[model samples]
Target: MSTPSHAAATAPRRRNETVIVFALSLAAMVVSMMQTLPVPILGLIRTDLGTSTAGVSWVTTATLLSAAVFTPLLGRFGDQHGKKPTLVAVLGVMVAGSVIAALATSLPLLILGRVLQGAATAIFPLALSVLREEVRPQKLPGAMALVSGTLAFGSGLALVATGLLTSGSDADYRDAFWMATGFAVLALLAVALLVPAPRHKTGGRTDFLGALTLGTALLLLLLPISQGHEWGWASPRTLGGFAGAAVMTAVWVLVERKVDEPLVDMRMFVHRPVLMANLAGILVGFGMFANFLGVSYLVQMPEALTGYGFDASILRASVQFLLPGAIISLLASPLGGRLVSRRGPRAALGLAAVLGAVGFAWLALDHRHSASVIGAGLVVGAAVSFGYAAMPAVIMASVPHHQSGIANGINSISRSTGSAIGSAVVTTILASRTLDHLPPGVPPLPAESGFTLTFGIGAAAFALVAVISRFGLRGGHTTVAAAEPAAADHSGRPTDKAVRTDTADAAV
Candidate 1:
């Protein structure tokens, strides 16, 4: 059924497919690392940049805002234009951002660099879109699970790497950016060489007005959530930002309803399964971040005085408390993929909630010792892996294959939003409660009760996600539904030559 030349061409493509998955998975891990890489060294960055604490906070805030805005837009663009080019472009920009941050001598320069790096948030959904086109449906679940699992791996790796790199107070910290640069360079090269061009393009026009309004709305909403602690929760700026976001969102909705080709299709967005999955993303994200920030801070509490913590430095905290959980999450991903394949995402989500609740409850009752904290984290880490793996599976199964980019991008935003909220909540609770008996000028640490309360809240969040997943996701293999007939002639579609080759392989 195949000529010698055709067989040769098909053989190379089949070989390249495995390479493509490996490259994208590594890229996903690296980009996730970039998201949390700056948190541990914030004090050093503030001092080095010679900026006030509030000013230096922008280093993280800038990336969050940029990610929130660009992720979905770029995803939609990739669907309409070309995914491989878009992926390469996004990785290239991340590389450039890493360089900018590495050389940055001022706060604005560093913030600018982080903003550019934020563009890579779009990569996750675009990677998913690519996988949809290149990998077969039966293999899709496993490949996606690997990529999704890397997110947890990257987060943990970032903490350990940050600790190792910034061991001394005088450590340049710029070395971290250089590390990001190296990873970006590798990911960029891998994507360029191994990833085949998109197999389908939406071939539609951009909706500039919808994009502008949505961007404005997200910017306004995320600002108060990320900065509201400093601005005062009830301050005019915070409240006004929320109000403006509400107004802009209403307008954006109306505009999307009327647009010929909106930035996001409201119909796909409002589907029961899609809406439920996005909501689950927010809840699960809240629980996972609470675990990460809470444990990192908890271990750093001064054991000599706090009576509950090890009084470890950032490096020790990362090693003792964070590293184990991340490694567990990495392992849990493939297990999760098997579960998803056999049972379904709903089961996976339900298990995540049960495990998270148990982990948080364990910490809530017995967190005085470091082993207890780390032990609880190991369980919760698996929960996070399952949750992350399920979210995209739930999403991809519900939407047309072509919309995977934008749909997953929006889902990513929901998680980002939840992380912001979790950070703000934990920070406020820790700061608001303090130890009464202290030496003069000794900084306050969160009361043990505060952490207990936070963990209890995290348990509740996870439990809610379980409930949502049970009711929200549609029950069926929608894989066939995702492959629309219109995709047959798109630039990303398989040629007759390639189709015949695929058929022959299937027969064999």
Candidate 2:
């Protein structure tokens, strides 16, 4: 239907959009890599730094808490100021963090670097916001799927790379951080050059008080979730952490309600579809970490000692057992996007839930063989890809253009919380009961039953996702034009005659 001139103009625009998607996807992948890079090398780090297990655990915990604090705040900042500038600043910080991590000799210094890198978690939501502005509605789902897939792929890539880099007898864990530094720098350059500047801005004063309360609440909640096993689940610190989180959450809600311009709008925050999307995020997040940790640990168990494992080295666990799933996740992205485009996000999410449950059930029932572990992991990887594609779509469909960054940011935090819980649950289950009748001087290994229990729990989480998709999602689609609210100025007054046409209002 387009004329020659229109077609010619469209070609370049399409190319530009493609480049933009690539840059953002790369940035997202880098952030994901940062999160998982320490997983394979934690033991090495402990030895090098002479830290106890509890001390090394903080390396990962610091990043999680930092992400919880920064993601929503930076997301909202982008909405108010400008997404591109905010993205640039965040990436710059990531580069600095990676450099410091690469050079660090002390655990505290390394943890500081990780905290800075964790702030880059904001990149994912900001990328989604940019896609909304620059890409046509028809193309958005596919682009989002591609970007979302990178999170899983990058995570696996980190494990593989870390294993490979630290495989030698004298290898240093710092090598992995150096690799991250290179990738972060590349991502920074790509985003700077390729991504277009923001086309929409919601100028407003940041609610610093709201950010503080919410950040504190999340910190209190996640601290115990990540460290509960070490702290003893029934310890005063753990119980107090939960109690404080509940109190802080109540105070945050009250603060939000009273503010003229709040950090989060209570109406939108409580919207059924958005709420359901967040719930799905948590479950999906939990399932994801469960698969990663449960499989990695199970496979790497010394077969001679355990009599049930593959005796995989860290490298083998990463390359043989995990890399295939990551590749499948990347391959599934386009398919997931197609599903979202044709059947709506609810349908895509339902597919994710089905595949995830099946995958975990497979792992639970038959995990002795490499074929079983790899096959089940592939299915779960695809499920993760689909779930990732659908989540941002639900958010974009539910909220106005201006609120996209923070809305997606909140969803991101939900997923992180889920991942923390998944990791904790898996750790606790595996450590709960060690194998009986082990040889003298043998380290205590988890019983085979522990892996089965962990996978069963993962299956339950995904099954819950299916329940949410069926009961909680209604009117969950929107055309590109309708996604935008009525055009408004910095003061939030209408600046154009366009009506708010998004159908997600009733459903969300």
Which pairs clash in the backbone of model 1?
199-492, 199-493, 200-492
> For model 1, how many clashes?
3
Per-residue lDDT of 135-223 in model 2, one digit per residue for the tens?
A: 87789889999999999999999999999999999989999999999999999999999999888887979989999999999999999
Give stretches of model 2 more than 4 Å off.
475-508
C-alpha-based local distance difference test score of model 1? 0.83
Q: Which prediction has the highest TM-score against the true structure?
A: 2
| TM-score per model over all chains | 0.92, 0.95
User: Evaluated with lDDT, which candidate comes out highest?
Assistant: 2
Q: Give the C-alpha miss distance for residue 296 in model 2, angstroms.
A: 0.3
Q: Worst 10-residue stretch by lDDT in candidate 1?
A: 499-508
